[model samples]
Target: MAVRAVRGAVQVDRDDPDVIFDETCSLVLEVIRRNDLALDDIISIFFTMTPDLASGFPAAAARAVGLTDVPMLCATEIGVPNSMERVVRLLAHIQTDRPPAMVEHVYLRGAVKLRPDLVRERRPGTRGPGGSTATG
Candidate 1:
């Protein structure tokens, strides 16, 4: 099996903990759904968010959705001037039989603007993140 990294991000409307948790859950669920991944396929997940989203940790929100035993961490993104705000991003590593080119990358809500090229080029046989050819 190959280890593939699935990239995903979602922008929350505000800094409230509840909103953070809810949006994060949505992001994670969407990633899993789009990739057709099972729980055991996940190896670890790394979450990062803009410095402004301090109300909660995305890792904790992931745990609330049955990722409790998986290794996970949360970090703050570098505060670049005028960069996007309230965005929670995740890099989930998973064991898959699929080739590198078949992995899917997800971007939802406002975060979709971050990678307009991927959103626009997401049709079958297009390239996903890292220039991997996406079959989905």
Candidate 2:
């Protein structure tokens, strides 16, 4: 009955709906799959995209991936100095019996560079720098 939070990010190919939707969908799916989360286990999701990306709502990507009833929100990322462009980020609150240490966060595509340590898909039973247990 523990609530765990999973974070993930992916880079959009462009401002086109097709690129944004497809990449966002793939990222959300991975975040769910990597954590072995049930649809109902999800509590809410927070999404943010760089100012340059505005072709679609990333929440729609959640719906496209079958998250019909989950509460989701989207916002614009703050423009920072020398920041990466076309990036979309997501924070998912999920319920699970697993401890927080067992959760695996995701960062894909260009976003992978943001957290290279967590981006690589390694085998299960690995221990990350945070001392958290990881799987994919």
Candidate 3:
């Protein structure tokens, strides 16, 4: 098995703890699912949130999702002028046979805008502006 790093990020609606937990969980799960990873395969996860986000640590959301024994760390991203706000990013190290090129990096919500080259088409049934169904 080869060690690989998976990346993901989510844009939270606000600095509320609940929103951070929900979005962080969603982002973490998607990264795991897309990479066909088992929790046991994870080595560690490092999470960083934009300076504007102070509601809670993103690692707490991973714990809430049953990552009890995993080594996780959370920190504040370096403040960059005109950077995106309310963004939480994760870099997960895992053991996998898949080649690095095959790994799917998840960028959900407005975070997709951060990595247009890596963004896949939005899944169906996703909500769009004003709560309408998002369609390609």
Best by TM-score: 3
Best by lDDT: 3
lDDT of 3 by residue, 6-49 (tens): 88888889999999999898888878777788889889999999
Ranking by TM-score: 3, 2, 1
User: Which is the better candidate, 2 or 3, if ranked by TM-score?
Assistant: 3
Give the CA lDDT, 0 to 100, for residue 118 in model 2. Answer: 65
**Tens digits of per-residue lDDT for model 1, 1-136:** 8899999898889999999999888888877766788888899999999999999989888899888889999999999999999999999999888786777678877888798755645567754433356686
Worst 10 residues of 3 by lDDT: 126-135
How well does candidate 2 match the true structure in TM-score terms?
0.86
Model 1: how far residue 128 lies from native, Å: 15
Q: Where does the lowest 10-residue lDDT sum fall in candidate 2?
A: 126-135
Residue 58 deviation, candidate 3, in Å? 0.7
Model 1: which ten-residue window has the lowest total lDDT?
125-134
Taking all chains together, each candidate's TM-score versus the true structure is: 0.85, 0.86, 0.88
